[model samples]
Target: MSRAASPDVARNARPYLYGGEEAAIASALSAGQYNHGAVTEEFEQRVAAFLGVPDVVAVASGTAALHVGLLAAGVGPGHEVLVPSFTFCATVQAIVATGARPRFIEVNSGTGCVEPAEVLAALTPHTRAVLPVLYGGRAVDLTPARPTLDTRGVTVVEDAAQAFGSCQGERRVGATGVVTCFSFGPVKNLTCGLGGAIVPRTPLEADTCRRLRSLGIVESAARRAETTTYTVDGFGMRVQMSPLNAAVGLVQLDHFAEAETRRRALWRAYATALDGIDGVALVDADVDRTVPPMCAVRVLDGRRDRVFGELRNRGIGVGVHYPANHTQPAFSPWHRPLPVTERLGREIMTLPFHQHLTPRDAEHAAGELRRALVKADR
Candidate 1:
């Protein structure tokens, strides 16, 4: 594709649509099965099979996946969940949504992931769960901390919104035993326009998550249609993935291998280009095992703001992934000192990343960063 034909480097990220997506959406519309339908169920099954799991529960969005997963894990009021403060606020808000306090933990600066020691150290008498955010699509291995967590009865629910196609050890991310949640948002590795899924640990947990997403209705949609009465058992929310979005997801899943390959190649191209550049350090994604969502770097010497400004002025897209959430006004009541996250808030920068751009685009973006760094220092 020509530079003009493609979404140029000025775009930080956008959904990469393969052929037939429009036709799939049209077919779903023609069927007129907008809500819980055959299409959505098929999407769920395909996702479960791909991850080598028995079942996957579909939901409206990634946040919904976290909320439902937490609730299904028996997390509720009077509980404390250990979580990293370096991630997007949605992770923190999900804990708050469950009426649980988030005990903020720190992450390693190089990978932007919570270390095993951090999880082990943050534990308290009220701790009920450990929520690990898979930043930049890199898997966080809590193997060393699992024994203690299990002994304490603290469940691990991973926030894998950015880690859809990434791997952990021998199996893919969601296939791991822990309760994992994934987002199929527009710009994610897999796009459903707007959707998410939960990989439950047991068949029982799967049923609970399904019920939670469907407003605690005891009967399935088919079962309810044959009867005059439907039972609402407990507190739940209406957040099922729509058939329209599922149609898009099925098409995207068919072409997911291409996404994995291209994303890895683009990340490598950026790594090669940025090598030996002073005043910048690449945030390692363990690219051999990660399908990176973005190429992140730390700009040193308090130069990130100026470098970001320079790139934007030159029409090269640059972004900050997140600000520290613990210090936010809404979460201040639960705040604990996180010095590493505070420093990362000032240094982290993300370059333009998406499947639409080629390796040449990666080179161009890195070149622009090098030039901006020179300008910022002078």
Candidate 2:
């Protein structure tokens, strides 16, 4: 296949390097500081500065961030954490790992995110936390239920894995006084290769997160290096982000503004191309505030499967972001009827989206999607 027609649209998501990651990794390797070290600390500080937060705790993966953030917020056995059934399984798993039951909830099909009313209506006496997912790089606002949550002593720990660099109104997602967690995975808005960060609500919580990620060690890395003994104040996990990954993150952070611009432009292109298409409705991410991680559309008329297969055959990457977790065998114990989420599971389809793609690429993908939808209708 030629470059222009090489099925470049076959990729649903991919990591885009700014040509500095290789050198950064090389430098990190040469320093021989493979474990958590100065590079990791620098990355944490940089992210803290970017989010305008007092501190940010780095961890091994987005799942780790979720796990520790929940733990830090006092979620554990016999507790119920409100979560949407429409999110990636990892979100539910994190709740499970904290020994909490996931009280499955529904999302607004339009944006695939949980709403404050849905959360407010689902609360029970056991409700200890609300883990709102930032679906498709769109920030979820649960402010309407804030007073109730606070009065009831429930914490809001955000699963913002896909929303790095995205905003929540006037301020950024992490700056909204919530326990926001972000993933810098290979295909996220910001790639740290395989890393995540937690924006704690206070300096004390930040310290708690740091200790949690590093196996409850009371002493800092520098302090441990100088002392023969280290203290373990409580239960914890070995999930700290490695210096090597942090090195890559530092470089990615430097070019994040360009990433924001390119991703938004591409998402907008898809919106324009698919504007009047029949049998489909775009899942709006409020692009003005979101740095969209994917362009999702709802294939109406019970045609999502057909359209998906058609697009795949045409080499236009298409996928379902999630299958409703409530119906999944693993989560059946807490299963509740989420009719809206069930329908969303059947309809959601994501198109190719990545920094490597251009506006032209989005247009091409949208055109192919239209063709697929028409074929399904036939």
Candidate 3:
């Protein structure tokens, strides 16, 4: 199939790279440090500080971050990992990569996140972990289910790929979960061309994750630079972040506060203009706590596809955050009635989102969306 046409207002734009990123990349190139190096360490340290986590290990991609995190947490074959089917397929793929069986679960209709009740009901002796995604940068209150999870000895692997700067109460997602993963992909809130990070709560988990990011080698690239030889005592993969990507991440981190403010404002603009429209309504999320991953609205008139196409015709980009994962052929065996996930798969529509968009752009998108909804209704 031909590539989907880029819209005048992109659904999600590339990271806002500033002069600092250009310099960081240039410095890494001049130093001849292409693989993970001092720059990568600096980026990791900065992320650790931002998330208030003990330590973080940078990786090649968000998927890799999840895979290594599972391994570090000791999830293996015969183990089951509970995850919501409303999220991106990468969450399931990561579980399969570690030889763990993924058990699909329901999400709260309002938040599009897995609720504690659903998780509690799904917990079994084979369940080794629970991967709760912060849907659209909205925080999942794990507190309600923490007691059950703790009693069952289940690890909480937070998928904070879309929630790098978001928080619940005083604690950030990364700081509260057993291990949290963040994505710094091309279109994410914090873009690094391509990179991710694993925030481990303990020193041992951090070391394990660090080794897993590399080829299970005990020593990091920086350490091997000083000495020619390295050792590998555990299984691992070569998923380390490149210095170039790390440089971009560092710059993005530096400017995140300003970018976050702009992103939140744009999200609020959409919420103000789009909420309570005749045929569509914005999904529930805590704007005060979330960094606003995307502006997703639920079409109530069974016309999500029509609205999406109409918006595209008007040069406004739109997207479906995802289809229900359980319905996919690969995960068919795990398929069951996920009423909320299935409904959302058809109702949720993602509008043009990114820090690059302005309040005026948001209003325009909202107006166009309302027109599309009206047309779909007709």
Number of backbone-clashing residue pairs for each candidate, in the order shown: 0, 0, 0
Residue 357, candidate 2: C-alpha displacement in angstroms: 0.8
Residue range 1-378, candidate 1, lDDT tens digits: 134323478988889999889999999999988888899999999999999999999999999999999999999999999999999898899999999999999999999999999999999999999999999999999999999999999999999999988999989999889999999988999999999999999999998998999989989988998999999888889999999999999999999999999999999999998999999999999999998899999999999999999999978878998789998999999988999999998999999999988888888888889999999978
For 61-145, candidate 2 gives per-residue lDDT tens digits of: 9999999999999999999999999999999999999999999998999999999999999999999999999998898988899
Candidate 1 total steric clashes: 0
Worst 10 residues of 3 by lDDT: 1-10
Q: State, as a TM-score between 0 and 1, how close model 1 is to the true structure.
A: 0.98
What local lDDT score does residue 90 receive in model 1, on the 0 to 100 scale?
A: 88
Question: What's the lDDT for all of these models?
Answer: 0.93, 0.92, 0.86
Clash pairs for candidate 2 = none
Ranking by TM-score: 2, 1, 3
Off by over 4 Å in 3: 1-10, 226-228
TM-score of each: 0.98, 0.98, 0.95
